[model samples]
Target: MDKKINIYKDVEALSEGFTSLLKEELSKREIVNVSLSGGSTPKALFNYWVANCKESIDWNRIAFFWGDERCVRPTDEMSNFGMTKSLLFDKIPTIDKKKIHRIHGENESKEEVQWYTSIMDKYLPKENGLPVFDIMMLGMGDDGHTVSIFPHQIDLWNAEADCVTAQHPETGMERISLTGRLVNNSRNIVFLVTGKNKAEKVKQIIEEREKFADIYPAAKVNPVNGKLFWMLDEGAASLL
Candidate 1:
């Protein structure tokens, strides 16, 4: 795996760096397809974009997708898509409604997975029979989980489908997530991780890979034909 680690002094700096990176990517491509993750970590990035770059970027050419979402109504605070809409999408009026491809988290888990999979197949660019997202912004949990692929349910990482239904290890709440197969096909994969609580797991997954590969679900994210970047705040990179 060709992995690159970038550590920022704080969350604000990390958010700015990510925003700049996204802006650069969007400028380079006429149409950029990005899959976003939901977490406390990305909330700052969303806000930063709204405040600084919202008007400068060409919103119409950028299509939004999600990496995973909890099975909840769009109005629910727990909904990933809801958080994103409130923070980012709602602020960008120029973004076309058709470009915002959200998972119907209220639908049945398996049925939602199938619905999302078909959407991906129809819209995403395919390379080697797999959808290749232009950019995939992901966040890692303290448990070394990425997206909805928790450590206890690591088997879901290798699922053959582009998307699958996942159950949270502790809560058993249903989630629809993009499989590792689809994530690995991305053109660029960025892990935006923050907080001191995630320090050890981040160190284990990035530095001590061989030791934690079997246990850390985040370690399984190795882009076959794209660059993998770890954008961390000082708190998250302390153990590294």
Candidate 2:
């Protein structure tokens, strides 16, 4: 469960650094498959990647996926697909629409989960029956939750299911998330957290937590046979 943590001062710097790393990874892999998390920080990074890395990427070789999303229409403001489209897809002309796979959380949570599972099963590298993603970009909430796995719901951490449709306790909306095992199977995992509010949880996950639990979903992020990196803004890294 060895992992590497990276700290930054702000979202802007994090975005720049991440975009640069993404471009480099793309150059090396030729085909880059990544699962992205939803949040303001990632939205900002999407915009930055669109503007800075669009031409550098081999658009057709990149596949886009989300780590989790609210069960809302693609047009909804809370929709992760909508945010990525608005901030990135619409701006990047080289990318083929087919390469950007958006989970239909709006229409079918279970169906989408199964469909995405099939997609991952078809595309990702497999070891011991699990698809190992190339890179999974995640975000941590102020409460220490990453993806839709919230505190008090550690059951999600141990979920043997590849994906699950759950409800956000506060929002009461449905969500589809890849199980911890699937995420930890990735070749690389990077968490992008911003704002001062997240500093405490970042510190707790990096310093205080041992095993991944519902109370600290981010603590569960350990890339299988790879590295886990955290890209944090100053406010989020303040406590670290």
Candidate 3:
């Protein structure tokens, strides 16, 4: 059974709720490992954490991981790890570099994928022979996709692997993403969605979770042993 599912009206409200939840998890577990997603909403929340909730995080005891990443150099501005560093790591003295497990997009993509998957397999909780992430943060695109799994990409949706590299149909850029199996095995999954453009799909996801499961990639997010929480602003929740 899931724990708690919630939605917020604004970023502040969402951040407040997330912060408290994170602290509670940290209090129970000495070492908290989290899988973070990229994009505008998360970038904003990362900045907010650095500026406001830095003290609330037990940085040294927390390990960072990415749910997905654009295949780009770490020094590239588009790198998810880079964004997190600029927004939070550099601002806080509580966390150590070694604690952050980044997806090496600049290296051989296949090798990097295998390496990271092994790391998760070795560290995360296991059930039915699959790694179970403690927490995973996700975002939805205007097209109703989440993480790097775009529409019409049947391989990504049904992948049984832990991780894989995929080509974005439109952008033609490569992406490294956790497979649905891994995502669905998490203990907690949070969707931080914003923007008016996402309202339609957000409504579709929340209302027709099973009906649209095939077309809307966002609807496929089913953490086997986790709670799925959606945090959205007014614009994103308008249709919901």
Candidate 4:
């Protein structure tokens, strides 16, 4: 139940707010494993870091992973890895390519899930038998989904595996996501959400007054031995 909510004036300020936290964690940890999220808000953050944090932050000390990825070619427009590569990795030539442990979305679903799960086990530090990430970035869908686990698939939050394949409710596109067991075990869980579209669910989850608010995967983002944060822009926090 420990949570921190930060409301920013705009996406620019939101980017600055998260960078402050990221910098603090970087200063404390030798190797920071960050689980990246895909969405417009996070896009702003990746761009902000590449442009503003390039000089101050040491790319060598950080490793990048994704919270989830669509089952598509990495070059596809819907590919989360594609977006992050274009925005952050491509901009920072000094970044070590080996530090990026991207999910092979183009690879067959079952095979890729097993590969990524093993990669995480090998790279991340473990606590309570689960890999612990320094930071797990998340996004809240309009329907209150997070990490590709739709409201209809809320049960997957506590699935047995560290990673699971989730099918998009509407699109039916498959996605590989770090299950809640793994995400909640991380050292830090951050929800970087924006836009007016997110206001309704934001209010509901934060206040817990709306009916079925507990059903949201985003609402269950409690870190057992870590921290939970919701960094929102004015539009997203409007209803709060």
Q: Give the per-residue lDDT digits (tens) of candidate 3, residues 1-240.
A: 353446677887888777777887888887888899889888888878887877767789888898888899988999999998888889998897887889998888899889999888777768768886677888988887787888868468788678888878798899998888887877778888888899899888888888888987888987776788887888898886
TM-score of 3: 0.95
lDDT of each: 0.90, 0.80, 0.83, 0.90
Off by over 4 Å in 1: none
lDDT against true structure, model 3: 0.83
At residue 131, candidate 4 shows an lDDT of 90
How much RMSD separates candidate 4 from the native structure? Answer: 1.3
How far out, in Å, is residue 59 in model 4?
0.8
Across 8-121, the per-residue lDDT of candidate 2 in tens digits comes to: 666777888887667777878767888988888888887778767777767778888888888989999999989889888888888878878778877678788889788888
TM-score of 4: 0.97
* TM-score winner, 2 or 3: 3
- Per-model TM-score, in order, reads 0.97, 0.93, 0.95, 0.97
- Which residue pairs come into collision in candidate 1? none
Clash list (residue pairs), candidate 3: none
Clashes of each: 0, 4, 0, 0
